[model samples]
Target: MRIALFNDYRIGSVNGSRVADITEVVDTRWHGTPYVINEFIAHWDQINPSISAAMDRADTHELAGVRLLPPVPRPGQILAAPANYRAHVSEMTGSRHRPANAQALLSPREVGFFVKSPGSVSGPSDAIELPPIPGRSFHHEVELGVVIGKPARGISRERAREHIFGYLVLLDMTMRTDGEHQEERTMRKSFETFTPIGPFLVTADEIADPTALRLRLWVNDELRQDADTADLIVGVDELIERASAVVTLQPGDIYATGTPDGVGPVEAGDTVRAGIDGLGEMSIPVTERGW
Candidate 1:
């Protein structure tokens, strides 16, 4: 089932062009505080039956006019892979005049991952705010976002799938410059409005294979990124296992499985649309942060 947060953070199950409100299905009073995304995911299994029942009811709203927010507005962590795609790595290395040696094509085990600030998260309708730093070129990295369903630590690669809640289309908006170093890379990436995720959170059961999906991104009408997840140097399972070994994967944590090549700079007034085959697509506007 497709789950979404729309029109004032109300949770609902999404059908074609319609959404059945299921916000009341789960008991949201968490010892006086309203149930947040993390609490909701913790109780998902128990509340799922009621959500399904709510979807069957006649009371529904049109999906088109509703405003959709990031499925998890503020996740506990946002783990992201860098240079995980062979083509993407090659493009970076060749452009920088680095030798395309075996050392350059590091595996996921070697490259590890980086943590993006949760404050960078934004929804589908939100604008990709371009930072005003001169000489900084903003680019879009379309990736398949993985949402964790349960808390896990040191999970095995064999059982990694059990922890996943679902998937979504994620755009890792970035600022790049020539000859950027490691520390500069993280600083540029952590800017506000850098992560745009949403449209829908497709349940994992609905997806046949996460590693076999096609990812595509466009700047206005021009296609900038086009590649398959099959090209990933380190697939989803290993990403979860390896990441979880270092830090506990909480229910509302998100992992962006890196981007393929064809990443290029975007300017103000550009509309960016990115999608994963079954998950969904997000089209967000780009605007300059007036300095």
Candidate 2:
């Protein structure tokens, strides 16, 4: 099932061209703040049956009528893998914008993972706002966002699939820092409106093999990034096992499996669209901060 959160966090189960309103059947306690989707994911074994039943009798809305929010809004931890793709590793390593004082770039297995502030997440329809800081260029990293369902710590890669809830399209917008006062690595990617995710979260059951899926991104009308997940240096399951060792992976926790090569700067008035097979696609506008 494609689970989605629409306007005001109303939950729904998506069908082709329509959504069945399942929010009424959802437990009211998970309605606001901290980890609303946690209960929905952690209890999915119990909730899935109810949601299916509810969808049969619930009101349906045209998919285009409602605004789609991030499938896991306000996730507990927004973990992002840096340089998970060998092509991206080489691209950034050779880029003119590569930080002068930065350390050597390597695959995620060696570098570990970094966190993007959960506050940076926004819906598919929202605009990507560039901050007022001058002389910084914002680059787009289109990636696969993995949502965890069950809690697990120190689990093996073989057990990783059991903990997964779903997957979604995510754009990790990065601000390239320059000048004498450089922005920290985490800070550079944690700016508000930097993480745009969704359209819908395609449940793990819908996809038989995550690594076989392909990801593609476009700026305006031109294609930028196009790669297959088969090329990932640190695949999804291993990422979970590695990351879980450091921090207990909780329900609704998201791990951005990192982007492939072709990341470049975006400017105001440009539109960004990204798609992953099975998980769906999202297009968001880019604009100067209106503050």
Candidate 3:
């Protein structure tokens, strides 16, 4: 099922040209659960049956023509895996560098991860604000966002697929700056309005294979990043497993699996659109904001 948050945070299911009001279903008994974005994830099975039944009995309502919100507007945490793409890692650390030294140069870890404050998230088609900081380079990284369904830890790559809930497209907006120390790499990358995810949540079951999807991004109508998830250096299952080893993967938690090459910048007034083949697309306008 394609789950979405729409019309002033109302919980609904999407149908062709229409959005059914299941807000009543949640209101009748699941009031404490809140939006479909929140409960459909945290208690997937709990509401799955009710959601399915609601879809069957839904009364058609004129499409609200409402906008979509990041599938999870307030994910507990947003874990971003940086440079997980082979070519991206090479571009950051010259290709001549060794893996061990590359890890040191990046500083976070061999994998180099960062946390984007949940408040930084905005939906696709939303506006992106450029912070007032001068000389800081801001770049866009389009990535595949993995949504967790079940809680997991110390998971094996082979078993990672079992814990996944769904997938969404994400833009990991980055702010670049040299760290305090000469050899350090603590850049303030996780900035507000820096994470753009969703248009909708494409349930995992709807997709046959995650790695086979085509991912692309365009800025102001010009293609900037074009690639396939098949080209990923470390695939989805491995990433979930690797991350589970370090931290428990809880329902509603998200992992941005990194972006492909063609990293670039966008200034105020630019429109950035990105998407995956089966998943949906998101177009966001760029605007300037004061620090």
Candidate ranking under lDDT, highest first, comes to 2, 1, 3
Q: Which regions of candidate 2 fall more than 4 Å away from where they truly are?
A: 32-35, 178-181
Model 3 C-alpha lDDT per residue in residues 1-291, reported as the tens digit of each score: 777776566666777668776665553454324244656677777777787677778755554477666778888878877666667755666432223333443322365466778788888657888887765656778999999988979999888878889999998887654433222222345567788888888889988998988889999999999988897777788878778888898888888887888888888888999999888888899899766
Candidate 2: tens digits of C-alpha lDDT, residues 1-291 = 898888778788898999987876657876753355667788888887787678888888999999888888789899999898989988888676766767888777998999999999998979999998888899999999999999979999999999999999999999885554567878999888999999898899999999999999999979999999999999999999999999998999999999999999999999999999998999899999888
The order of the candidates by TM-score, greatest first, is 2, 1, 3
What residue pairs clash in candidate 3, if any at all?
Answer: none
lDDT of 1 by residue, 9-76 (tens): 77768888988877766566642222355677877788776766666763678999788888888788
How many clashing residue pairs are found in candidate 1? 0
TM-scores for all candidates: the values are 0.92, 0.96, 0.87
lDDT of each: 0.84, 0.88, 0.75
Candidate number of the best TM-score: 2
What is the lDDT for 182 in model 1? 29
- TM accuracy, model 3: 0.87
